[model samples]
Target: MEEMAIVFSPKYYEHNTGRDHPESSRRLKTVMRELKRLNLFSATTGCQLVEPELASIENLELVHDPEYVGLVKRICELGGGLLDLGDTVVSPKSFEVARYAVGGARKAVDSVLDGNYQKAFALVRPPGHHAGPYYGAGFCVFNNVAVAAAYLIEQHSFERVLILDVDAHHGNGTQEIFYDSEKALYMSLHEDPREFPGTGFVDEVGEGAGLGYNVNVPLPFGTGDEEYMKAFDEVVVPVARQYEPQFVLVSVGYDSHYGDPVGKLQLSAAAYESIFKKTLDLASTVCQGRLVAVLEGGYNLGQLGKLAALTISRMADFSYSMKDGTPPANSNVARRARRVIEKVEKAHSAFWKLRA
Candidate 1:
């Protein structure tokens, strides 16, 4: 398998968010600038810049509401407005930027479909995972990764797509869209229900035929490096192996980084590095490394810079340094995370044969 990694950057379109917003344009600028300094983007014998193409509304409708899709277009036409409950702002360029978000996802799918690359990373913003089929929340417009997954199902006829969300917050929107389908498995590792947008409880397996397809491992606050890795080994990797997915898509949010303003989890850069490496290894065994990761959230520009570089390097087979030592994993948090994982395993034992 030929391993190639592509980063989709549309920082020029990051114009709608306010100056002080945590998900500001500077976040994208910071990642891009740091990646450049790290030289993973060299034009000579290095990462190639991949141009983005606009995703079709027909494709977008695969995962979003028609009226909601129309509303986004209309709001974008209104020059500037709020899409979410004031968390997401939209300007004339907002629609254009949102298109790039979707575009980057679609392009990544295309590259994989065309046999040009084994792995790709859509380093985009206006982070998704909070937006649903009919509503947008938490600084998101269209559910970019969901749109790509749906597009693959409809057009390419690819079955068995696994969405692995490592965001500190639950990917409620993504879970809602594919909740009742067995063809797609939605799993997430997030802070417990006490956290924001609070909906990912253990009992919320799924409704109808999709029973047991959704897995939610809610880690307690202050969960850091060791706790996160233990959860991965004890839960994430095993569940993924049992699913035997044909393709993998990750919602790679770095908001779990220790110093992130909006996040309470203490996953340091070392923890992030471990997960990145492990996920790539999982992709290798499952989809011949046919995995695509999108930027979700990481507030501290310094931490984001370090984590993003580590993500690119691992997926691209480059070398990098891990932080000296990650924050200590709490014993209480570990106990809580394991309980959550065991409950999920019991719930879905029939589906994926998850071991306790």
Candidate 2:
């Protein structure tokens, strides 16, 4: 069995959100170049590369409304346009590319579950996590990670699926999609929602049966590796250990890196490596190493490629380090993050025990 797999498709670059858009085709191009530079294609790495097929309508309906799906297809068929109130845009081929992205995520899930790979990373584009059941938002036309989670539940009969979203922005659409579902636990570590989609408040636990299943740790601006690691150790680690999911899916977004232009968080490539190591450890202990990471957001080309390469390297039990000289967190941000963590723990305490 392969230790790592990268789900990619040339069709992903055909989405064509726009030339000036932050989520552009050039993002994947830079990532591919970096992976090649790192010699990931060498025969010794044992990393399998899989090109995925386009997702079927049946699969898309698992997370998206049929009408919304039709609208996206029709819009793309008519030569494409803006998709939502946010940054989501589409060209003539975006619908196809978006479907392929979803398919790539699903393929990753299948590969991991079938023991073909211990872990897989879907490198396709038109980043998801922002697209909800009814609308596309934040450059996401379809919720790829959510679809993969739902697929695991319905197709594979998995009971608990954990989605760890490390995007700078909260995965509002993903939280919304699975808010009422106990089958999937959605946890997001993001910059404060007052800045972006405005949803991942500490108190906004899930609605019904999923009331405690959705966890949000909203950090302050200028939050760096120290603050983030603190939050993860205090909140994420405890909650994940209790949930004990059968599968783990990460909404991998490099925008949280300090070098990224879209997000203000002070994370470096080393921070990303640390995050991946923690996640892989959790998957190994609880889920039998059934983990898959799907691309969500990252605007900067240089950091995006480096962070991703470092993550995959770590997945293969190797180390590739890059330091971006991330700044230290101030006392104010640390205080704010501590307060947020407290609020999240108090709110989720009704559902999950805060400590291991």
- The numbered model that scores best in TM-score is 2
Question: lDDT winner among the candidates?
Answer: 2
Clashing pairs in 2: none
- Model 1, runs deviating above 4 Å: 1-3, 43-46, 322-324
TM-score of each: 0.94, 0.97
lDDT by residue for model 2 (1-356), tens: 24788999888989997778889989999999888887886777768789887899999999999999999999999999998766688999999899999999999998887888889999978888989999999999999999999999998898899999999999999999999989999999999889789899988889888879999998888898888988888888889989999999999999999888998788877778888889989999998888899999998987788888887888877657776776766888888888888888888887888742
What lDDT score goes with residue 38 in model 1?
79
Quote the lDDT for 320 in model 2.
Answer: 72
What TM-score does prediction 1 earn? 0.94
lDDT of 2 at 48: 73
The digit string of per-residue lDDT tens for model 1 on 192-235 reads 76646768877777888778778887778888777677778877
